[model samples]
Target: MSYPICHEEIIEDRDVTAQLDPRGDVAVLVPAAGAGVRLGPGRPKALRLLGGEPLLVHAVRRLAAAASVHTVVVAAPAADLVAVRELLAPVAPVTVVAGGVQRQASVAAALAAVPAGPEIVLVHDAARALTPPGLVESVAAAVRSGHDAVIPVLPVVDTIKEIGVGERVLGTVDRSALRAVQTPQGFRRGVLTTAHAAATDPLTDDAGLVEKLGVPVVCVPGSEHALKITRPFDLALAEHLLAMGR
Candidate 1:
């Protein structure tokens, strides 16, 4: 089955307590419909099992745990909307929507479902399942502190190389100036909506869309625990990390 870019299905847990907290002024959008080709998938990346739970479950659980986050909207696979909603109902009060073909479209769909109360919106990846609540709070705090855009990043540590067409190394590229970026990338509600409205090309991260609008994106320290699970090796590593209580 196919769904429109803005198709949405809201699922709420009445038993769950009010989502608002002392600093609850943030909403998180999760685009989770990507097929995990790299992981040699049996299921969609977000639905893949991790530590006995779906990656989406782990991700949303953490996001819901954050004091600043008042809402979470997930863009799930069109066919799996019911399943995804059922999966998340016990975990948190979330609104599930049919995701679009591309990640950008899914984000846009999820963004549309965000209610008005939250002024700070965050775009997070479901593949980063182990991202901690602290990181969520940090990103929201940065946005709340008056920054229009905020993202988590870590310094690149590996030796860099510039490659040619035939897989030849042209030269050693500078790594000092490069940083590895991560999410839940935060933005003021107006800033994010405006960026999306003005977006032409689909970029890998929301910050890239904002960059095109001449907005300065601030970066905070990212945690190793936020490593994205993309491959089988990454899954194993995540399992190990989980066992180690990371």
Candidate 2:
């Protein structure tokens, strides 16, 4: 039998909490440098407002609520590190570093800032600002339980298609084996560092790089609340979700 994640699970921080592995001292790295063109430009993606506050503020606050999360390192837009730092200070104690043009580069920058003691590191997305602290701890716990890499995922619900060209669908794809992967992807610090070191191509997500290293990646259940805020519609929906205290 499993219990639902509720407000009572929240710790000393504002609105969230998590169950943690005693051995997993965790550091979270957020790559927030992306210019979300799909979000219609104006502000950097992570700096974009949700529920009247920057996404970074919400994300950091939720992350710090986890008992085992010892540090948060955010790779912010190189030009706005000071402002980003200022905005998030009231939310959580974070180390802000200058981010890079590409997502992978920003992750590398944040990884460098992670302190020495944490045995596990999680690479999270700032766009997934509403991720539950339970999911965060679940990934960390998996890493501590001897998994080299861990990711939270939801089963793919929509029918899939394989398109060739010119908007043509070549064949129907299988959804049963597919998953919509979410972030705060956890990794052993050594494995993550090695994966980054060997990375040659730039993939959007960190798990792909780990897969390239022949490291096995494990999956855990994710939350519906952990939606990635991308478009204008997503932002509006997220506001509603937050307002209702979902």
Candidate 3:
């Protein structure tokens, strides 16, 4: 329909900077396939109790409660899949599937399970039961804002050292540019898929795969509260932290 626009045309063109804001669906991937060798014979690392509940249960609940997250998926081990399914069935709508041998493979399996089309995906360690919801939200927000990937990291506070075999210190390492990375690591679905697809070797973290793709991964401040439970001492420390409400 052609309309008539006959009026005093005042064209005031100023640089209206529009902030790049992108929003789309999100999925949280929790790799629960590990046998918890460090934690000993158990359902999995995810099923280990951190404070009062299972570690995985806590992560799933937090993800479900997060405003930016839409779905939660667990790539679990064949031996522990049934237990994880039963334990987390009531907390949130989770899809439990068999995971692969390595962490990268597990994450890839989870990504494969994610529904097609563009989406924001977060790969978090289920062992990190106490990971703050804020961390998840922040990373997810960054991914939603058109970032290929986002990671939460903390500056290495302890004195760095380049140690060799048998606890021998090779030299003093620089801590200034070093950071200890943490999870709830978020990524755009396409980027994650491509990164995983191109991956040849097993990576310690998913972001390593992204780095191979040569994408600049955005980093956000991490929290001490979001510690990964690895050793017996770590478990004790987590208990202490929870008790102190830190």
Order the numbered candidates by TM-score, best leading: 2, 1, 3
Model 2 local distance difference test score: 0.84
Residues 1-246, model 3: lDDT tens digits: 211111222112221112213233678899988877887776567777878888788778877766666678899887777878898889988889899888988998888888765388999998887776666777777677778888887777799888899999999888766677888898988898899899998989988888888887877767677889987778888788768764
Relative to the unseen true structure, what is the C-alpha lDDT of residue 6 in candidate 1, on a scale of 0 to 100? 14
Cα TM-score per model:
0.91, 0.91, 0.85
Q: Rank by lDDT, descending?
A: 1, 2, 3
Error of 3 at 111 (Å): 0.7
Per-residue CA lDDT of model 2 for 55-116, tens digit only, reads 88888988887887899999999899899988988888899999999999999999999988
Model 2: CA > 4 A from native: 1-24
- Of 1 and 2, which scores higher on lDDT? 1
Quantify how close model 1 is to the true structure by its C-alpha RMSD in Å: 8.7
Pairs in clash, predicted candidate 1: none
Off by over 4 Å in 3: 1-24, 165-168, 244-246
Against the correct fold, how does model 3 do in TM-score? Answer: 0.85
